[model samples]
Target: YRVGKAPVPPRTSVPFDPAIFDATSSTFYSALSNVDFRIGAGNAGAVAVRFRVAQHGYLRHVDFHIGSGLAGVYQAGNEFENLRFFGGRYGIMSEKTSPAWQFTLIDSEFQGQRNAAIREHEVDLTLVNVAIRDTPVGIEIDRGYSDSLWGKDVRFENVSRAGVIVSAENSVFTQIGFDNAVASNTPTFVRFRDSGKTVAGAGPRYRVSDFSYGLKLAGLGTIGDYATDIQMAPLARMPARRTPAIRAMPPVRDWANAHDLGVKGDDTTDDTAALQRAIDTHRVLYLPVGRYRVTDTIKLRPDSVLISLHPSLTHLYLPDETPAYMGVGGPKALLQSAKGGNAVVSGLGLWTGGVNPRATALLWKAGEASMVNDVKIQGGGGTLLTKGSPIGFGDPRARFDGQHPSIWVTDGGGGTFAAIWSPNTLASAGFHVSNTKTPGHVYELSAEHHYRAEIVLDNVENWEFLAPQTEQEVRDGVDAIST
Candidate 1:
């Protein structure tokens, strides 16, 4: 290499090999921008892209197509924007322990195949208008770090498990929406970290529910300050306590129509294919008042408006093994949205034909931007559930054997479940919301004869049960709702 006073031509391309950029390697320095890297799936490196402040390097507009098990490593003072990560285990993984590691992501989208969308370990991070989808977990921050995680206008969609699992202190999350999280073992909007102050908007405020006692007390964290505007909605405004209404069916108007697929809802024939076709084809999928047998689980899309002609007439029948089959070796949801979007499924009677003790009647893995309004979930009231069998504990195989929840809401935040009436005698809890950071409201939820708890909320920061007449039994535990 020769030294020159003339303007040096920039290195237009560079091989993104992990071995060359290891911690022990030379201090690699570059001011590279507008670079496209095709990191092959065969690369078995632990980290995909790592930058060191010692080199004073910055990467921008760098599109990466990484293979499996690789993560985009970042350090402090690095500015990344318009960066797209596809098919990687961890979309963006920052393990910087330095307080000066101020990493910022703007206008980026992380489409991970599995694992966390962004895993930051002891790093001061900020994400503005970033979208993460098709991943299992989103934005996991572990190990106490310097300063809070500042995020605004961020969206997490179609994740399998948790939306944002953080253990960081002083984290600030605002204008964030987590959508379409698939229901799985541990579904949480935010988990682990009990520290940090959160300021949210007014019209949409949160409430704290459920608690833990005994040895878990020491491990329990605080739900920090939530600054909101005045004149918010009342904590408990009871909905109308009348019988289910039969609304007049409206004329077809939405673009996506299910009727074009010949879905005649006769219980004998399998309407799964036709129904699924309609759901895939139209934005607004309509179902007439008829008993439809769905052999397979109907997957929902984003921004889908599924309407039932009448709550009493529009019915969906599930097989003997419902979500129980999900617990077993089969896919169980009668209807589900794996990649959660703003889907509204209204006015339908979902019933299980047989007593498959390990099944789930209705599962919402989609984000909180979805809804299941005016829908009834029922389990076949048989001697099997009433006889009272042994409940399993501490075992994954026996997780839902003798008991199962009628409805399971996971991950998807900002969705509503209004006027949900489930009077069927079930084995487990009536409703279960797990691992959701910001869960939408539930209005007029009526259910009875649950063997276990009525509703179970785990790892939730805030929730509201707006049923004044619908008395609920609170679990006897320590008062764990204080900062």
Candidate 2:
């Protein structure tokens, strides 16, 4: 052992190939989930201490050694969901060098952190439905002004220190919910303690109860003279499940062209029967570049993977006709995937041949790791979806004799929707999550231009809507406000 100074150990580098991993296409990959990583026993130079998660990507559904003990992130856009961190020195620490803005965390839990659950600096954060248990400090935010700490359903129980520790780093708090948190000895929401890193920002704005309930409710400790907001109820009210219902890896079957399978992509033929037959028998729907017309609905097989040569090359044209509102599921969607379906529809184009405002472009009922990506849509109802469903246009649920949304989530099996653009859609709500008993997670959501409310939450207790980018609020709709 050295007596004068401690010697630094050598750093090992892990190998990663972008072409092999292909992380840019989120829907094509599933290998990152359900992985477990363990390092040596707790030591200063343990393998876990030297390891760090890749900067600006997803740490989803994997249990790492020290709970993604990430530091020195190179860029932004990193996401974490459904990950559990235990027995780690700290869950995730953003030091002075980390410049990632608005790192999103959803449906994750942290326990047995040696010091704190999170040690943040200079980064704005969005934490939804996250639980922190048995931690000294749940979260220690160093800066306050430019950094906004927005969270919903964030619970803290069996904590040693406060749920969050701050140094007046000047981070602003718009949506703060610590009314349900109990931590350390005092059980405070935000403890104005010293984290040693001071930041300069604005005078932080806060909104707790909107002229309804009084501030400083009983059992909830004081936030500080500068504190004044409360949070929504029931964040961790349910369990988060990440199991894919169809329990099979993305198939590696040989591609089969739809035109070769007795189905023509010509603009006039009613290819509904032929396409449905193809979707039922085949595992992959690799259509060539052409417009395939269909009069009736197409039922997608549970394990089918419908991918196209290119979105511009392949198209599904549904003609406007009499209402085919089948009460069995909801609407006879142009493309329907039933319960427990692990369908994958990607790189295609959908167009309602006529002004058929009665049916959705796609009704994805089975969201168990199912995905619909890179599909351009025009006209018709937008979409009626669960956790992992996508959208096109219009509200198919309106003609079903009930108010329906472009995004409807009823299942609790939790999934994700990314790069979703719903510019033109006729629906009661742009986003709706209801009729579920378990907590769900949907991150990187961007939707707009729908009727009624842009955001709607009813009967659903805890759903993590992380990094939502919503715009184009309608006149009658309340964007981002749950009613």
Candidate 3:
């Protein structure tokens, strides 16, 4: 695989031969993307396609389904993008537990799921730029809410029972919304089964249109618009994704491993010198699952790649009693980004050891050509800081109002700090996006438990934010990432 660049394989549709196509059990962070799997009405299995245990993954441009049983996708949290499932018994039957803790479907299609296009329960659900058609029930929130649900710009066609179903037996939802929905052939847009007391005044910012054959639901009132009120693409049509041409990839053994270089990740030993030695020796680094305690910063080589597939499993921390790297407030991070620029760091967790309020968690000055995605930061004053436009002064040269990218942009000299697809991070502030002159890019921020604002924006413009959710929580008694 190429370093610092994401793999954009050729867009091909192939039959789902479980032996050859399914890589579900290959690796923890394996990406099954860039293809389509069609099941045209043949009896498949109870489950057609699902990555069983992917905590931080992004599955893009892949279609999978079964003719019988549950024929939809079972993914949550920054999982699906540009996906489609048609000619199946059901659309999406997902829960809150496996794969991830949240259900996020962006820019996808669900067709002919005669029963329910989406059967959601437990986790926080996010649906943006989605289309559901030819289904009896479109989006069925049949179960209780373990978290929140936020959606926008969903197109529906030929939906019979309702565009959405919110069960009354479910407990009170903390947050729920489905704004600006466009539908066709859908009667009774949002039907509240049983009583309506659970979601009556829940402040749901949802509306199902098509203006109805006559009227709308009970206590929730007349939902949606005239369906034709907004202009949108036809139902069940997923836009084609443009990507770079496919290239040959080398095997994994060529890269360097920190574990092989005599660095122990027991969290008790100060792995500073050995870690520094590993960094000095290798150009590409891989740290396996384990927590490594460091007392000093380990510098990085130029244009290197550091990967830890499981962020929740691999951690790098600083000891609580370790002396501050420098002066006032300990302005250093445990794992410092390389001044070398053009680095790729993904799938790792970094936390300031102990509950040191003045401790700084992370500092990203890896130049503009660098990227840090799927990395979790916890327990510090400055949880994360992306210092410049692309490691320099703001270059308001272009706007970022472009298509959603599954991976971090490599060629452009812009700073990208993506933390785990759509996972709800608990911090003092959700997003402290500031001091940039870049424009025309879109972001999907799903952060919660902020001391101040879910999104604290300052000195930026022309960017887009989609289906954002914010709440308040404090981690480790220290309010990190305060805007």
Candidate 4:
């Protein structure tokens, strides 16, 4: 009998299976009705019926249909839809009819407690699974792992190398002792102690940079009120060698006259041939105190040193109408050997016309080296000119065009220029030391030429111009002096 909100009539019945049907079925049409239902038997025999209700007011899994007399007599399809199960359990029993069966219930609620206990149980199980999955295990240290002490005393070992060790050796300053030394009375091989303030010893100190160059070793260490002791180191033994002091060669006299190489003092004519003769004989040429005029250019050969007998006051004159007094081949003239190095033109008053600025009173070639001292060069109240074409000025056609007087001195290689006295009313560079490829040369304003190559210009000065001035004024002043 089924009993619920949808109650069935008393005699009404329907075939039922506890496993397949529940009390929620509309077996009873009214709440006030009661009905009896029967479940058919299976193949073996009749089975006892069972009904179980859920807390959520629904019928749970229950077994009823088993071996019975009505086996295979009643058949029901498994497919069902829109079945409600919430409440007390209801049972029905009926006999099979016409090999088929139909349900009678429309809608009914089972009588039981309604709660969400099953959902809560599922959530608890999920939490337990998460806890088990999240538990930590072990850790690993990779090759890239680094700690604060990575670069310290400890280091990774490389076994394949020849001189590699797992542990480091002790430092050189480590303590050492005898094998039989007592454990509590170890003795050190070397003794080291810091000196107190009262004790006498040296310490580090700082110095100012401004006085660094003037500072001396004796001034480095000093005691407060007491003097510091300096211990000098022993000198090492060494081989000795003789060294001599160099002295200047004395002046030679009558050396040129003996060789028939001498210039007349009173002769005002251009003595180019005599000068060339003296130069060819490689003798000391002498131009005694006189105003000897030179018309053409005079070139000096190697191994020939020209010397003037007179001192600074004597005068050697060059006519204002003539061309340059002296012109040595630019780079062609060179001092061949150190012994052959001697040329002296001294005690001469040189005069040049300002109109011919390209004319040089004295020109030295690349290999030629000479010294002019204690001589006066006066430009004839005009610009003294100097110019040299390819034939005269080495391989390159060089032109020197300026009002400023130029005395070109060149060593076949290159040399230096030293100015003794700065020109007045104009400034003139002293000497131009040439590079190896070039030669050294010197350009003087108006000056006397004296002394040998060694110690030349040792004590030479120009009376007319004694101060340094600008280049323009130097050119103009040189021109005025030459004129």
Q: Each candidate: what lDDT?
A: 0.53, 0.51, 0.51, 0.25
Stretches > 4 Å off in candidate 4: 1-250, 257-262, 309-317, 323-349, 353-355, 366-375, 380-405, 410-483
Tens-digit per-residue lDDT, 214-263, candidate 1: 11122348444533221212123222222211122234665344555788
Q: Is candidate 3 or candidate 4 better by TM-score?
A: 3
- The model with the greater lDDT, 1 or 4, is 1
* Candidate 4 lDDT by residue in tens digits, 1-483: 233343333231355333333333212111111222234433333313222121011111222222232211111111111122211111121221111111111111111111100111000000000000000100011112211100001011110111011111122211111111011011111111212111111111111111001112445475222222222121132112111111111256534641245554343555555655666775455555554444555555554445544322223333432444224323211112222244444434343333333344444442324445334333221112222111221212222232233343433422222122222121122222222333332322222111111011212222112111122223233332221
Candidate 1's TM-score reads 0.41
Ranking by lDDT: 1, 3, 2, 4
Poorest stretch of ten by lDDT in candidate 3: 398-407
- What candidate 3 gets wrong by more than 4 Å, as runs, is 1-45, 48-63, 73-87, 94-102, 106-124, 127-254, 273-283, 298-302, 325-330, 338-342, 355-358, 366-370, 379-431, 439-455, 462-469, 474-483
For candidate 2, write residues 68-180 as lDDT tens digits. 34421222244556677776667766632221324566677787877777776655566766778887877776545224466655656566556666655333342333322
In model 1, the worst 10-residue window by lDDT is 207-216
All candidates' TM-scores?
Answer: 0.41, 0.48, 0.54, 0.31
lDDT of 1: 0.53
Candidate 3: give its CA RMSD in angstroms.
13.7
